[model samples]
Target: MSEMEVLVEVRGTLGRLTLNRPRALNSLTAEMVRVLDRTLSRWERDPEIACVLVDGAGERGLCAGGDIRAIYDAALVGDPAPKHFWRDEYRLNTRIKRCTKPFVALMDGIVMGGGVGVSAHGSVRVVTERTRIAMPEVGIGFVPDVGGTYLLSRAPGELGTHAALTAGQLDAGDAIRCGLADHFVLSDALGTLVEDLGSASADDVDTLVRRYAQEPPPSVLDTERGWIDECYGADDVAEIVRRLQAAGVESARKAAETISAKSPTAVKVTLRALRNARGLSSLEDCLEQEYRTSCALLSSPDLVEGIRAQVVDKDRDPQWKPALLDEVGPDIVEKFFAPGDDELGLSTVRECDD
Candidate 1:
């Protein structure tokens, strides 16, 4: 029989979840998301389950992100599957954040996009030196979703802004610095940690993780924050790029070049979303906003082209419509945040009860 995409196991008081698609870097399929949500919900309600531990099978990474190829195909055929997948996925993220049981995420390797949504929201987020995290949606003509803006908006200074626009990877220390992860457990020790977790009570999970944890190596992102904060602080994407170019730092100038290559519309929308997320009181609100943005991008030419170039075509040369940042007018950006009929109604306010 084919292996399950997500492996669920109950070991004593610890419920274990593993993303099982190793070859695909454990990219989440819609079914996987549904399974994770359902499994987590079941575990949450189980009185005997004191803690839930999530990890990924195989050596490469926990999860790269959601199945982009699936998203690409859905976007091509105008399928409504992505919308439904995201709705459930975002709800799962919210559930992780609010989980009554000790929700522990072993963020051991490549965690990005939907992966971040799953792990970063957990109560006890553990990372290793092998960890590489990112929210790289802009590169594919997409805004960061799955409550990404909420987490990124809360990152210290504009490091989050830099990450959003540049689609850069964050190392273990950087992930911790950005508030995406909590503890640093060495890669070799993760097995022992898992064994420890299997026997450890819910109340002792935090202490057990700390016992295995060590101080992360210093984050280069933190040292570069002076320039990153200065460059990305501007509200406008174009202005941010201009600042990066003018900063006289090679890294800053490189960041400018990187941002220049991403979808102009996506970049602008990402900036606006991150800024808007800063004001939101809860992750649910940010998810609602992201749903609007994700839905809006369904019709975007850049979405298809970006995916084609980056994934399908592997050409790395996307012909983005409205190619330049200036060409992506405020109207184009505004539509991404506009109220939608099929809103993922997780937030309570709903601008005053319909």
Candidate 2:
């Protein structure tokens, strides 16, 4: 009914997309998701479209996240928009991953939550020194969706779990080292890089990107890999906390504190989802599992309470129902993953023989 929030254009052989809501830090709306998903699908089959390049309109970032205020409002009023939005968005994530074209994502700023959805599945993700990437759904009483479980589950060591628990931002180097991003380019050089890629033939896109990619500084994630793996790779949330507390390093202490303050259900479910994701065969399957868990959590009181405290009231204090990890039993965790009639209907998985 309204204009699309995303702008699609063609420059030479590149199918270009700019997120148009800079005033809102390019935070995604349901309309934005629909438009982006459809555009990528269309461009995938066009012979004239060599690749798709996506970036944000503003300087602040590519995308902050989905417009959670909408979900927060609907949750408060018992509306179903959040449910429908997540369903469509998850399917779109799958489409981006499976698309035939080379999809380049400019993740130069605050890439988190739903923003991660649109770009993490790209064929090539470019991060700059300013890249501040994370999957911070736990803060809002949700686990990572939009194929996040798949991405995090595959990250080097336990870096993914640490990010999930802490909602910490990763730099360009860290994003590359941790596998969130594939290349690092200097912030000032992005425009020229975009031009080169835009004008290159489809076959030359990779070469053009390599020509512009700069060597990233060393990654703290790589340096701290041992600590992250030792702490987050433990049995469960409680075990991870206990280990971090026992370690007594300032970093470990801070990590423990962050996990301690997050929603208990979100923490435990996130842990389970990450572990489950490690064993899944495909991104589509991980998304299916995430869809089930998301729908279940959306129906829970804690999500609404968390949104009310964080986004609506600005209280910074959510009275979570199962306030402790121990209180959230396996039954509660399993309930979120249980089969249901409203299961997200993703398209059939496309496979290629090796």
Candidate 3:
């Protein structure tokens, strides 16, 4: 067959997976998602596998997210690939969440978008000092997917809302502080942690993790929580922007400017998605909603322009349609949630009970 996108190995009681697209920062493709979902299912049933560990092959990062250029291309031609890609990719996200085997993800360097889906739901989520993570889809005329809304909905106060609107990266300390990571392991010590975990039983995994986890530095997000909560608490994007502008703090102003730069439609829909996610009972519920929006947004004007400006042309300027947030009313936002004939095709996963 073709070469493997992900390297898999089974040794002793440990099953290890290394994302192999180093040049691409392990960005997920449809094939990679298929492999991961299928492999994890088998490993979960394997008696020899006590636990599983996943790490990126290269030093750059675990995974930067999905291949947006590919998505743009698919959207351009009206190809059906994006739907199948997202449909299975989302199920894999739920698979990780519901895995019976103890799954540990070593999140080093940049992790965002689809990368978060792969790493965030594991039983043991580990982040290192080099980790830089965000759900930055809005900047590219897309709302966050792969259960991003669920995470934002549950973030303390409006911190998740702030993250969604700003698409800002979080440092390792901020990640742990924000409930993204379970433990902080120094990057250098990761090799040793892997060795220890190779022989670790499910019961011993926690002890080994604790022994290896180093205390992270103080978190800036903790200090800024008051501002984030106060400014982003509003469900309306205009109200949030007004609050941030009124604050007059340099940080708040910067955040407002950042939000202003993104697609107005994206911002409005993301706010509504976050609001809806709060009431969802499980991650799967969020994924189902995201599936509908993902397909719907692909047909919008911003997806093509955002990808061209950011990735293809390197222009760094996307002329968002409905240029102002006020132009994106409840009617426009509602369109994103309603899907066409191709629904997400996911069976009931019972993701919340996990």
Best by lDDT: 1
* lDDT (CA) per prediction: 0.90, 0.86, 0.88
Residue ranges of candidate 3 with Cα displaced over 4 Å: 345-354
After superposition on all CA atoms, what RMSD does each candidate show versus the true structure?
A: 2.4, 2.4, 2.0
Q: Per-residue lDDT of 1-354 in model 1, one digit per residue for the tens?
A: 134888989988889999999998999988888788888888878988889999998998889998888888998888998888888888888888888889999998899999999999999999999999999999999999988999999999998989889999999999999999999989999988888888888899999999999989888999998999888889999999999999999999999999999999999999999999999999989999999999899889998899899889899999999999999999989988999889888886423113
> What is the model-wide C-alpha lDDT for candidate 1?
0.90
Candidate 3, which ten residues in sequence have the lowest lDDT sum?
A: 345-354
Full-model lDDT, candidate 3:
0.88
Residue lDDT tens for model 2, 99-147 = 7888899998788888898898988898988999998888889888889
Ten residues in sequence with the least summed lDDT for candidate 2: 345-354
Please rank every candidate by TM-score, starting with the best: 1, 3, 2
Give me candidate 2's TM-score against the actual structure. 0.96
Task: Count backbone clashes in candidate 3.
Answer: 0
Model 2 scores a C-alpha lDDT of 0.86
